[model samples]
Target chain A: AQSVAQPEDQVNVAEGNPLTVKCTYSVSGNPYLFWYVQYPNRGLQFLLKYITGDNLVKGSYGFEAEFNKSQTSFHLKKPSALVSDSALYFCAVRDEYGDSSYKLIFGSGTRLLVRP
Target chain B: SAVISQKPSRDICQRGTSLTIQCQVDSQVTMMFWYRQQPGQSLTLIATANQGSEATYESGFVIDKFPISRPNLTFSTLTVSNMSPEDSSIYLCSGTGHYFDNEQFFGPGTRLTVL
Candidate 1:
């Protein structure tokens, strides 16, 4: 089974400060982890993914995520937080080898609030 | 990247009525997916829509309650039947990318409010 866990329900960060949203996962095989952001009343937008690559992956809006295989964690990061970055973030995982490869298991989601 | 569009961005229906949501993709895809998100909840996969085959629904979801149709490689529809207050949620549709990794691109989603 492939599952993702986002421990924080909400994270607050001051403007221009670095922010991190924690995510962890469990999968039978190699994990294909993804990060998505959903604004108010909007659909989810893909941020970045970690399939097989460097531990640090950069994404849109100057956002990045660190994939630490040792910790089984893929935490989303931002160098400088902005008010416009406030939104709901979701972490998802997909199994590398399985009949249910197309299916994605999502986390509970984390709300990021950037204070001005 | 795939461009996906959904019809009737939002709707309000009575308890006994049914509503059908349409999803159209600009690019051809082998698999399309339908998801649901209730208020303050994460997205849950409702079913997988594949061309020329019956939609495969996830656990706790039935075909009779949420019938799906994949008429072609680029279009699919999900109809919510016998609606109730519990059915009020945002229904989303997505298409898998052509790449082997199968990244997904999503539609804006349809918000249904059952009264």
Candidate 2:
């Protein structure tokens, strides 16, 4: 079975400061990880994904994530926080060699609040 | 990246009523998925909408409660039947690009409120 865990329910960051949202996963085989952001009353927007490339992946809105295979973690990071970046963040994982018909498993989600 | 759209951005219905959410993609995709997200919760996969075939539902979900249809590669629908207060959630439709590596794009979503 594949699963994702986001330990923090909320993360607070100051404007112009770096921020990080922690995420870890459990899967049977090699994992495919992704990050998504959601605003109130809106759908989730794709942030970035870790398939099989470099340890760090850059994404939209000046956000990035580092994939650590040994730690089984994919933590979202941003160099400078913006008020507009405040939203809900989700971490998802899928087993690369598991059931071909399976869907992605998502974490409970972490609420990000960027204060000015 | 594929652009996806969903109809009825929001709807309020009484108990025992049903609401159908529509999803349309700008480009044809091999896999169309329906997901449910409760208030302040992460997305939960409801079913995999397979074109020209019956949708494959996830555990704890049933076709009777949430019937799905995939007439083509670019369009699908998910109906929430006999809705209850517990059924109030945001339903999202998602799909992947042609390349396929488990990366998915999502629609804006339809918020359903059952009274």
Give the candidate number with the greatest TM-score: 1
Q: What is the per-residue lDDT of model 2 for residues A3-102, given as tens digits with 9 covering 90 to 100?
A: 9999999999999999999999999999989999999888888899998979999999999999999999999999999999999999999898987764
Q: Where does the lowest 10-residue lDDT sum fall in candidate 2 chain B?
A: B96-105
Structure candidate 1, residue pairs in collision: none
**Candidate 1 lDDT over residue span A1-116, tens digit each:** 77899999999999999999999999989988899999988888999999887999898999999999989999999999999999999999988886753788899999999999
Looking at model 1 chain B, report the run of 10 residues with the lowest lDDT sum.
B96-105
lDDT of candidate 2 over B59-89, digit per residue (tens): 9999999999999989999999999999999
Error of 2 at A84 (Å): 0.9
The segments of candidate 1 whose C-alpha lies over 4 angstroms from its true place after superposition are: none
lDDT of 1 by residue, B28-53 (tens): 87679999998657999999997888
lDDT of 1 at B104: 83
For every candidate, C-alpha RMSD to the true structure in Å: 1.1, 1.2
**Per-residue lDDT of A32 in model 2:** 88
